[model samples]
Target: MGALARHWTRIAVTLIPLLIALLHASGALPLAALDRLDNVLYDARLRATMPRTMDERIVIVDIDEKSLAEVGRWPWGRNRMAELTDELFDRQQVALAGFDVVFAEPDDSSGLKRLRALAQGELKDAPGFAGRIDQLAGSLDYDAVFARSLQKKPAVLGYYFSSDRGGGTSGVLTEPVMKREDLRGRPIRFTAWNGYGSNIEPIAKAAPMAGFFNPIIDVDGVVRAVPLLAEYGDQYYESLSLAMFRMLVGLPTVEPGFPRDRFLGRGYQGLESVVLRLGQKTMGIPVDDRVSALVPFRGPGGVSGGSFRYVSAGDLVARRLPPGSLKGKIVLVGTTAPGLQDLRSTPMSETYPGVETHANMISGLLDNRLAVRPDYAIGYDVVVLLLAGLVLAFALPLLTAPKAVAVSLGVLAAVVGLNLWLFLGAGLVMPLAAALSMVLTAFALNMSYGYFIESRSKRELANLFGTYVPPELVDEMVKDPDSYSMTATNKELTVMFCDMRGFTKMSEKMEPVQLQELLNAVFNRLTDIIRDNRGTIDKYMGDCVMAFWGAPVETSEHAHLAVKSSMEMADAVRKINEEHREKGLPEIGVGIGLNTGMMCVGDMGSQVRRSYTVIGDAVNLGSRLEGLSKAYGVDIVVSESTRQLAKDFAWQELDRVRVKGKEQAVAIFWPVAPADRLEKPQQDELKTWAALLKAYRAQDWDNCEVLLLNLQRMNPKKFLYELYNERVASMKLLPFDPAWDGATNFETK
Candidate 1:
């Protein structure tokens, strides 16, 4: 409940199914599928617990293929049926008999009507024809013959009710089991029909005790239950099974049974059961909201099925069975012949015989084992679902993984177990599909929400980082997907430009494929070093590979990383040069530049082609520094801004120069080595070089020459000092400039 207040969105999502199930249960928005699922669940439970043992007390007299073959096709004259009835009662001594077949029209197969018509029309002049027809009239009336056989017998005839007839009815309907006055104006809704197909007047009047044999077909067209009582023209009628059971128990009159506890109060639409009244004794036959009872099928149907014994009508009519063979047995006479069309699709079997359903019901009524979806079933479903739904909705978010699983499983088990207990222990058929579905659905949704929220973001970020950085940096870079995108923006970032030298000369000596392979190899080594330090590769252009930092993801040590990768890349080229000497390949030289400044870093280009790259003056200056590296005879050059930010390395001030596009001269430096790794001799050489630049810039020719001599002696291989020495010597012969700022200016890129 508290989860609904706090995590209302997730709670609301889980409640959608619950709300639909509730609506279905309340009859406001009926879900035919839900009812079908309930039937499926019931069928599963029924099949698992079926006794599979034969019921000796109840038997089915099947009018099957063998019977049809032996005694002609069905409607074998009502005179033959009268013989079969007499054999069941007088010879077989069955306790009660019920017909599952309807006799809506007279049995005219005897051809007596045709003979009388011929006598009145064409044969009227033949005096013997009329006289002979009158003589055979008493013996030829098949319906009257069958009716006489039913009189004074414990026989219950069968009929069917229908709603598609448009009030068109045939034959005569039996008296009501209970009248409208018996309900006392409670407005109880019974299964009502518009028309019926009952027995002819003679047979119906002979055996007035009758019931409709219409099993209640659910929306999915499966016979799960049968209405024990139905309504027709303000009169309630009993079912075949109920009628047979009532006659077996001394023909009790039926009364309406009302439940004392209908929680819905005035909204209750049906009775709990039909009360059977006999003297002061009354027995309650439980019914569902439709005044129906679920058939407690013992096992499968048909004669081969072990649920009930089957006696063939042909064998019984031909006296194949000995006298008293079915003594004291309650028999249901129904046909299984293909022509009869009595087969129905039941939960147990698709081609189940219709008569066995009533037999199962009769057996249930005998043992009081009829299962019913009670009048309070909807109320029960709502209460159970609300409790279970509330628990899962509120508890799942609060519990840990194992505890949540345990709680959900416990609730599911409780709901299923309770439902099964009602089915197997007490004979009750209640709604379970909705409750179980709600629990499983709610649990699944709640558990997935917690599990996928973080993982989903991590997965997306991993894809973004997959190509930008090395495999090792991906885990750390998975921060927020919303934090970065291809959208262009301005931020202070560090950009580096690395260019390969002597590439044109090397290509002249080697084949095109060989040159391509060599260039790729050199760039691969450098790119690995850059990505190793959290740098995003911008693009590879010719022999140069550009990279930057603080994008897609941010890092404060962007300049430090840029310088570090630059030094590492220079060393890697030296190793490749060593390999080149050993393998008889051309040596490769690298020049790298590093600068730190505010720049726009994002995906920017034409709509047809785009890239995640950087643009601005800082980037342009970094490129110029790469070009100046060859002029100054150095492998790596860094801008003053970068040197300030990256204080970990020993710096050598190279120059203050203006590139083609810039007016302001930015100071540049060379990273000699790590500050702690520089030796005393190297330190002295750097100081002497700094002094040489100071004297040269001040126009002290003698001091500059003296300082250059000392710097060359300290590091004779250093080209920067030699270059400055040449400049000083050339300036000695010319007039010294009064406005020189000691800044070199480059006229072209």
Candidate 2:
């Protein structure tokens, strides 16, 4: 958890996709890819669940190739259309017959206009041709004949609406299903058109009911839906399917329906359903946000699809069917001839019949089945994204690798399953693309954060500090590895510089390999001592080993640990010398120096070699102290800084000397042993040594000689007492100087 707390940046990255998706969902920004994917998903789902069974209520009267062959090609005079209508109503007795074609131009195949013109002109002066032409004009006028056949019949005509710049002028259109005032002056975004191609005036007045045959083509050129009601000028009109249904059920008046909200009065228009009001009773048809209905496709189109019973218009017109064979069936007169240019791309088929689109809508309307993409779909998308996205972001971090993957998959499944359930069951086509994309992207980001960022950080820390500390300490650092790096920093730490004394003479007595083995053996023991005290070994220079404490890992007992490690290393070297004596090899000497102060410690070097070592004046002093150790006849030399912090060990102050590269003299000391281990005689020797040092600094030659005689008499074998006696005898030759602070100075390292 602590490791996770430090990486807020990685956590924030996982939620970025969700934020973008939310912005898209809320309409602040829109993404085209998401919308396209949503359309693809919707198309797939729609195709998977389509009912292939036929709709028995609707039948298509196809003007197919056979019909065009038998009836002698298209635009076969209006008189032939009149005959087909007669066969459908008078003989077959269909409950309703709708023409999916428009008579936008007058039928002039009978030559009645030419004959009448001739009779009124030159022929009226010559013979009785005017009277003769009047007798044949009744049967020759094909438009009048077709119009008379459709008068007061159960029929509705299909026209087309266009968006052409040149407005319609060749036909007559019916009144709109509803007017703008019906919507209470609220602006609606209905699919609008500027022009139309309707039937001629004679046929239009005769039928007195018509609707446009236009399906809404999406950007991909597939007709997925149809606007049940659309706008033209300031009025709203209904599609052919809607008009046919209205005519079938007593012609209900259309009125716009809105969601009940007080905001409606404040100019917020949210059209929910289209209401067909009949007196006190009303029926509502659900529509999408654009006042459109999804085309509930029954199956693939064409006569082979079996979605609707297909009857060739030629057979129906030629009286081939037995009388009343199609009694009470709703007949839709449309052409399936390819040259007619009525084929459309739909979800079920690429060459779907334009007319059957209306047939399906009618069937769906009859069964009250529609899938609506509601206005609240954006809200649904945003909610699902938040839920699934947040789950992956916060939960994946706490889980192990396997669990994180499992949890992410589980979240994705839940999101997809719920979306599909709503779509298939409740007829709600909500936005699933944004939610699914957000979930999947968030999961990917989280896994990448762990694999690429956090895990990589752990590996880097292990590689950098692994050799400095023990494995256990390395493991602890890896948890929050960002806290440690190779960058140099200033820290208060204890630095140790232990050099092998008499290494030059020792190396001259052996060959290279043997000498290397001896040196490695000595360093192995010293390294073991330093590591045992939890100190970091900085580097090894020839026979000398440098180390430090409280770096890469920190502790308040750095000084004490360094002092303890130095004594252990000195003892281990002596033990190694004991084995050397038995092996007939030269005995090696070890001199160690320890100091504690603020110093720069970390990985520092050029490109070729990098080392985690300390650098500062204090570290230099520690090195100088190591050289002074042999001169003082002691095994370990510690500065006053280290001696003050490490109080567990008994200390003997050696001298106050100004070493090379330093102006002020610093006190130096030697760690004898634990204070409890010092005997009374050793204590008396140290007291005598202190008195001798005080008398020597006072320039009292007689007192110094007397004290040194007593200290040397106590332990004449001690080199420290003999060296101080030499120092006292040599100082007697120099005259007393008042400027001196009773400290010795060394000019060479």
Candidate 3:
């Protein structure tokens, strides 16, 4: 039952994140903010790479506010537009002239107004004369002059299509670039016009080709792509850009290639490329059939004041141009001023010229430098999301928390990098935001479940073992219960034993209550310092505190931590001494000793009374070193192993001595501040002390005494010199053991 419960808990921890990630990827838990962020990133990238100049073939005749103020309001009388067209064709030799504005309403002044004026003149003369005049010139084509100008030039008049009832006008659609049969069942809704704005008869007769200039805006209001072909009723139409290109190449008809169902289960189809067979030459235009081609805007400032030459209608009417400047150029007439409201909000710029956008598309079609979003992009995102979820679901169950975190970070980085490579290197825009969200959501959910569900029990276990083991160590044990058990085992760990030097003497002077209070305060402070340094408290023996490292938690720096903790404990004891002195009580001092060697660290007592503590030769040596601190007049003493680990700190060798029990001698040293912090004189004195220790180890009594005497003279407060002085005196009398080792043997534990 316990095993089943554990397995179920693990599964729950894994599955929760997987579900969350999948939901996030599928848009069930939509992240609108993320999508916006993605758009911003893409827009920034596009802006960074915007073309500074338009292709020489394309030109924009901006209907700017300046032009508007110069020529008077919009419907600049079709006759004036017709005059501009005549100048573009006859004077400048323009290859093609395309209008971006739609003339859905005919010029009333040309036709209706002329007829009415003639009728009014006749009515004034006689009642029957009005009827006779109306009969003579029944359809007095008032727009005859405007129609004559339009017929003189080769022009492609612009018109718009509307999905809503109120917007469509009466106009015919041109032939489609691609047939509906190519898209299978994908519905293509095209707009049809029910009315004409210009002289329809003249426009049809003059301009051999006309195309719709309608642009489709997406839900977000950004025009990323334009449809190559649109259908209205039974007729299909080409874009103005497409129609102009066909006219330039003299290709009456062009075809677009669209492939179907080449990606995942989702039925996907779009134009692979457009093929224009012009006379004897064939050109391939790259564009997605479904959406419009991406327009590379030059930027807000555009190519040198928006990078296009602006020739005003007023200038053309006045014949002020340098003459023949518009010859053989594809001319596009559109508004530029913000007040005109023809401005569009794009990812790159908030106030971009809509006509410039068309120019970019047309130029892209001509140059074949186009970007495409593949049909498989959506499928790729879905696959990534599901795979990320599944991986987290299966992997989270078997790994520890730290390992799981490492894996999650690695996976997240890989997904982000892959998306970036696809975009930056291949010009393919893969879904990074969605894929990233999936990985992050999975990681977060799994971590949450682990903490809220599994970690609570682990925390309880930690609390139970807190008195005997460090929390970090207990946590590690909980993660792998099989590897850790409350059994005695020997291992190399650093043990530290600290005790108050004058506790007994101080307690005799203080009242019982005061003594207890002081001892509690002192122990609490010292215990916390020990645990903070990652040392587990073994036991507190009255005034003595014992701790060790490398038991419940394995650490490579256990020796270093032990030495550091001992120094901290000694400093804490000195602080307590100051408080005791302020209260008119006897001051207290502490001695700490650290030793590193093999020791059994686990529950070590009768089953009912078991305590987590260390028991071995090294543990006893640590206690004895603390007791010997008073003899050496030093606050902290560390064995050779501990000294080696504290290489970053300055230290002075004290002595080579054998305690009561063992014959082998041990080397001990006192840790000082870091070497860089030591004064020059102090450093010199330390150097002398080292020389004295070397002499003593070599059993050269006279030289050892000489160096020790010099060191004591230089630094009178240095206890190491004093201790070595005594060692030299004793060694001089008793011939040193020839096989003497720098090992300190503890006589009593």
Model 1 poorest 10 in a row by lDDT? 471-480
Question: All predictions: root-mean-square deviation over Cα?
Answer: 13.6, 18.4, 7.6
Candidate 3 runs further than 4 Å off: 1-53, 69-79, 104-145, 162-210, 228-238, 249-314, 367-486, 491-494, 501-521, 528-534, 549-561, 576-587, 594-598, 631-633, 637-749
Give the whole-model CA lDDT for all candidates, comma-separated: 0.86, 0.87, 0.70
Ranking by TM-score: 3, 1, 2
Q: Count clashing pairs, candidate 2.
A: 0
lDDT tens per residue, model 2, 1-749: 78668756666887899899999988898999988898899999898888889998899999999999999878889999999999998999999988889899988999988988888887878577888888987789899899988998899998988887786555887998888878876667899888888999999999988988899998888999999998888889998899999999999999888865543122336577899988999998888778999999998889999799999999988999999999999989998899998999998888999989999999999998888887667667877888888877778777777998899889989988998899889888888889888888888887887777655766677678767776666766767786878788999999999998777997788899998898888888788788878888888898888999998888899999999898888888888888988999899888888888999987899899887788999899999999999888898999999998998888888999899999999999999888879888989988988888788778887899999899889987878888888887887898887777888899998
Please say which candidate is ahead in TM-score: 1 or 2: 1
- State the lDDT of candidate 3 residue by residue for 258-375, as single tens digits: 5455655255445555567766677755555364555645555332555566666677766678668988888988877677777877765667677777777777666665666655
How far residue 85's Cα lies from its native spot in candidate 1, in Å, is 1.0
Model 1 global lDDT (CA atoms, 0 to 1): 0.86
Scanning candidate 2 in windows of ten residues, the lowest lDDT window is: 259-268
lDDT of 1 by residue, 564-600 (tens): 8899998999999999999998787888988999999
TM-score of 3: 0.69
Which regions of candidate 1 deviate over 4 angstroms? 1-9, 114-135, 262-267, 456-749
Candidate no. 1 TM-score: 0.65
The lDDT-based order of candidates, best leading, equals 2, 1, 3
